[model samples]
Target: MKPFSGTSLTDHALTTGEVLLTYWKVKAEYQWDAGLAMSTYLNGLKQGKLLGIHCPQCRRTLIPPRVFCELCFRPLDQWVELANIGKINTYSVSYVNWDATRRQTPEVPAVIEIDGASPGMGILHLMGEVGDTLEAITRRLKVGTPVQAVWKPDSEREGAITDIRYFRPIG
Candidate 1:
């Protein structure tokens, strides 16, 4: 006895018929391999030493070591130890989280070119101990600032990048 009091098919095609819906909640676990060069690199980190791969063909030493030379397409076989000290290549002072959340304490991330690696070869790391105030930090920490890795204690290291807590000013 009751009829639907709604728009017709021509007016609203979707409103007249049933629509099938599906929800996929996948919980897939993945295990990634760091491969040969990175494996050795992580091993070195556990010991508080910085390791890099040497590309003989192009004569470049790469930091955050790689399995092959990106420039020459040659295998990187030689592992060279790098100085924990490096210079700030470039940096930024962030006031918000990556998710756009405002952070109570700003973070200073810098790209540091580790010593013994080719120019412009660097790793992204956080900056610390550059003074408390923005004026002091900006004055002291800038491009070309000499900084050293503040490594966490060996017992606390988990073969992760955080093994180096942050890069602190050398002087």
Candidate 2:
């Protein structure tokens, strides 16, 4: 791989000087169907709740609801309502946006293991209510820090994971 020059796009010139490249403005839309297990899980989010599938054999309650247990090699049994509160298992802070653009405020993303789910079984979500400075937020977002889901109003929900905007520190 070629070593990066660490220069901005506008600073780098094309190999052939005076050659103008035409850029295309494109727009597209895409869709994906999350069958059975995921569908039910998203529905629960729409209703301002959390749902998990229980594996009778291992008794593991899985979040984001799995249809089968990879460990037990059997179908997951009934759906169980899980506690909205949980603890931060792990996390990361991003200074850039999803498209790679830099932002003034960093985004703190964390994997919170739901209260009633099996150990280390958690969902990746943004950490909210943490103040702007990286140091301050990082200090507060320690592993095992208690948190709770902050749900969007039902009227604003679209049956997606975004239904719960982010998890905030539990008072």
Candidate 3:
């Protein structure tokens, strides 16, 4: 057996100038299936409607429909058509874009509790047509303020969440 003999790298050596490093940016692309539950939900949006799933055991309706109940651990199949109107459960005002760029108009994202779904069951969405200034939007919109979906023209819907352009305060 030959004993190993090599120069051990030290932290100071690596930190100073003893080590060489390389960096690369790789581009990747992919596609995925939305499955039965999500596909139906998205299709419902394209038709200017909100859809949810019902759990018979717990008697609770869930938005962003799931194939199973989290509480009962039961497979869910019953589908319920929900109303486009809902109340804002919570929200956030963002001045930065998704790419971390600053923007003049702030984006308001909120969790809206759909009318037909169980209480406290909500979906995360953006609020639009509210107001331009921070003070105006904050003054007009509240946690429980009612809002309705603003759908794009029927001809433009593409079976995606964006089909509902955004939700705005209902009067």
- What are the lDDT figures for the candidates, one per model? 0.87, 0.89, 0.93
Work out the TM-score per prediction: 0.82, 0.84, 0.85
Summarize candidate 2's per-residue lDDT along 1-171 as a digit string, tens digits. Answer: 999786444534555554567778679777988989999999899999899889988888898798899998987759999999999999888899879899898889999999999998899999889988889898888899999999999899988999999999986
Model 3 scores a TM of: 0.85
Off by over 4 Å in 2: 1-29
How would you encode candidate 3's per-residue C-alpha lDDT over 1-171 as one tens digit per residue? 999999888898888877875779889888989999999999998888899999999999999899999899999999999998999999888999879999898889999999999999999999998887889889989999999999999999999999988999996
**Candidate 3 Cα outliers beyond 4 Å, as residue runs:** 1-21
lDDT (tens digit, per residue) of candidate 1 on 15-50? 555544456989999999998888888889889999
Q: If ranked by lDDT, best first, what sequence of candidates would result?
A: 3, 2, 1
| TM-score preference between candidates 1 and 3, better one | 3
- Please name the candidate that would achieve the greatest TM-score relative to the true structure: 3
